[model samples]
Target chain A: MKYSGWNILKQALTGKKEWAPVWHKPEPKSHYETIVIGGGGHGLATAYYLTTEYGMKNIAVLEKSHLGSGNVGRNTTIIRSNYLLPGNEPFYELSMKLWENLEQTLNYNAMVSQRGVVNLFHSDAQRDSFVRRGNAMCIAGADAVLLDERGIRNLCPFLDYENSRFPIKGGLLQPRGGTVRHDAVAWGYARGSDSLGVDIIENCEVTGFIIKEGRCVGVETARGNISANKIAVCVAGSSGRLMGKAGIRLPIESHVLQAFVSEGLKPILPNVITFGAGHFYISQSDKGGLVFGGDIDGYNTYAQRGNLPIVEDVCAAGVAIMPMIGRSRLLRMWGGLVDMSMDGSPFIDKTRIEGLYFNGGWCYGGFKATPASGFCYAHLLAKDEPHPVAAEFRLDRFKRGHMIDEKGAGAQPNLH
Target chain B: MIINHPLLGPRDASEFIYLGDASLIDRPDWNSENAAQQFYEYLYLRDNPAGTIRELWFHEYGDRSWLVVTRNTLTHEIVNVELARDIDREEKHSR
Candidate 1:
């Protein structure tokens, strides 16, 4: 059903009984041309693009649990393309462009707010790096603005600009970067894909791959064995175990990254502000809650809950930049499993095995890269070639010594 | 998470530095024919299991010792902690 202002008024004038469900829940068929594992935003968006762009009708997106139960619903929802690396800046800028018209394309209100993002720099060296990143972003066709101390203060006056330690000197602002309602992305993509004859099978966990004669033929799921010509895996944090089952060990580690939301208060934060002195970024939701997050827990684990040490550390960083955040009441916190890649980037490429593709290792940037990750992944699966923007994200890049070390951190999953 | 140190009774996990899977301690022999591939696997690949796992943790703040910690990843329960130096010496002796 095409939803618009006219549809709402018509449904209101009638009894509202003619309105249909967003997407139909259907049983899985015996086989499909392509099978996508995991029903998160990326997986659903992959299926959506495969059908919409490539015109592949027979596709299925299998989810272990309910849709949007993974990182899609657990992120702080900030989106940006402010990157310095050639491999990263273009890909993220593609995602940012897709996000601009996502709600209109999906015909669902994703609540994409372009309130802008500011990465505050505390030192001259940090400012230099931000300048380099801003230049790279502009080269990649994304907008960037270098804001001095006064410019930053004009935007956010409540910051601790004169702190003795970690003083805020300036900032790099991307006017296009902002937040989106994370779960709505999943729903919109799911509904759009389902409308195009794509099967979105929820609660269907894939147990193992059917690799016959060294080529993936199908998958063994909780429901039944379903065959497919092509199988694309985009299960985020579960990438390690799933690919390991297929006899492939990825250069990825599963770590829990926590996110927090403070109790709802009147609007205080003007926009998303990131602390360059520390690993903390915060933004105020439309509902008036301050949503924020920091570094991942420095361990390899699949746990969805974090300890108090990280909570205390994140809150301390919050207080360092904006001292007023200490007055806000702590509401709740949660963790999502992130597939931390070796060089802090993502992969969207085919494996050595024919007809078997993989898409993961997004680390902390999966939520923001949802649309382009899916689109580029679809392009790869359809054309069997990497997208121009995502060409550097090959699994063999590490073996070939072409690692896109965006942070310049050498082969450290936790540091990335 | 409270990791019980072998020397000190109990220490908070915050005092320790997480070094990932304990399999890292069993470093592959450098003189082997597939030394390059083995080292690559040892450094990059991980088991990343969901249940009980043996891991390496350095007590950076308290005892200044690198300890092997056996814990459940899902439940975050510490099962055992032993001095990593002792384990290294034992591996050397067995070799």
Candidate 2:
């Protein structure tokens, strides 16, 4: 039952009962060629690419909870490739390219709106840094534009320009960056993979890994024991705990990051805008609610909730830039657990145990890196080699003194 | 969240700056034979448990004392607080 305009019209003209479920609830098999843990966006995307790109078969995705129950559905839905480091710029640019063709590729509506993303800079030094970052983006074949104060004002006139503390300066604009329907991405990939004969088993929690000698032979789950030649762990916040079951500690810490949405109003923000002096970033959703978030709670926690101080701090930062948002009635807020790595950058690499792979430590930026993370993880599983764009994202980078500390926050997961 | 500071009784958690895992207090000897591996583990690896854990917090806005705060990561409940200097001295005596 391929989704198409003709099919939709035919179903509409008929009794509208011809529609099928988005994905099948398939029971887990005893064995599979590869087992992908965590049925979040990355896991599903990895399975999707493994089947579609590598022509692989007998793949199963195991989820502890239902699909889109993790950060994939919890993110602010913004996507961009405005990175500053060489190790990251090209990979995110590849993700940006993938997002451009995602809907057509999956035959599902993902609502990838590239309205643009503007990273605001409040001072002279910040402007210079943004310029350097824009140059880095351009060098990586990603679109970037350095917009002056006038340009930012033209895009968002409601910004506080005359504030005595941190006045508006300029911003680095990426015209090809914006928001996507977050949950739809998971559904699209899930459906696309399931339609291609991949089993997606939900509510099956992986309790441990079965290691035969030095190789990972299978996984012990709450449902039962399942075997696979290769097992890939893509649980974002649960990376540390999941891998810990195999007696392998990770260079990752789980932190709670909260996101907020205000009462629906008329459209005000044209694109994603990030505050320079603070960790605040905001964009208006299609429903006219302002979707925004700030820094993580700055502690190690698996709890998917935050305290009041961060909420107040994020709200203050929001008011510092766009004062009008202060008047908007607060609607709802929620937290998502994020895997903050030592060097801040993510890892898409294999582990010491043969045939066991790991993909996590996305910090707070995993949502934007979903496509590339999946594509690269699939490439690794299929070819047993890192993708060229993700070659630097090795598990032993820290041990080899090759830390990709993008924010220069050394060995501190919370700061990153 | 409130941190029951060892020195100052019951203070807002915001007054303190959180540094991760209290195990960081046990710095490995650099001159050991397995210095490289030990340093790697010290810098990268983490228990990151979902249950009760001890972590370091600096009283930045209040006193200049460093405290080892034992808190449950799952519930964010502070169980105990002690001066890091006291803990360091106790460990030294044990050694």
The most accurate candidate by TM-score is 2
Clashing pairs in 1: none
Q: Name the 10 consecutive residues with the lowest summed lDDT in model 2 chain A.
A: A406-415
Q: In model 1, how well does chain A match by TM-score? A: 0.99
Model 1: how far is B30 from its true place, Å?
Answer: 3.2
Please state the CAPRI-style docking class of candidate 2.
high
lDDT of 2: 0.94
Of the native A-B interface contacts, what share survives in model 1?
A: 0.67
Instruction: Give the poorly placed runs of model 2, Cα more than 4 Å off.
Output: none
Error of 1 at B50 (Å): 1.6
TM-score of chain A of each: 0.99, 0.99
Q: Which residue pairs in candidate 2 have backbone atoms (N, alpha carbon, C) closer than 3 angstroms, thus clashing? A: none
True contacts kept of each: 0.67, 0.88
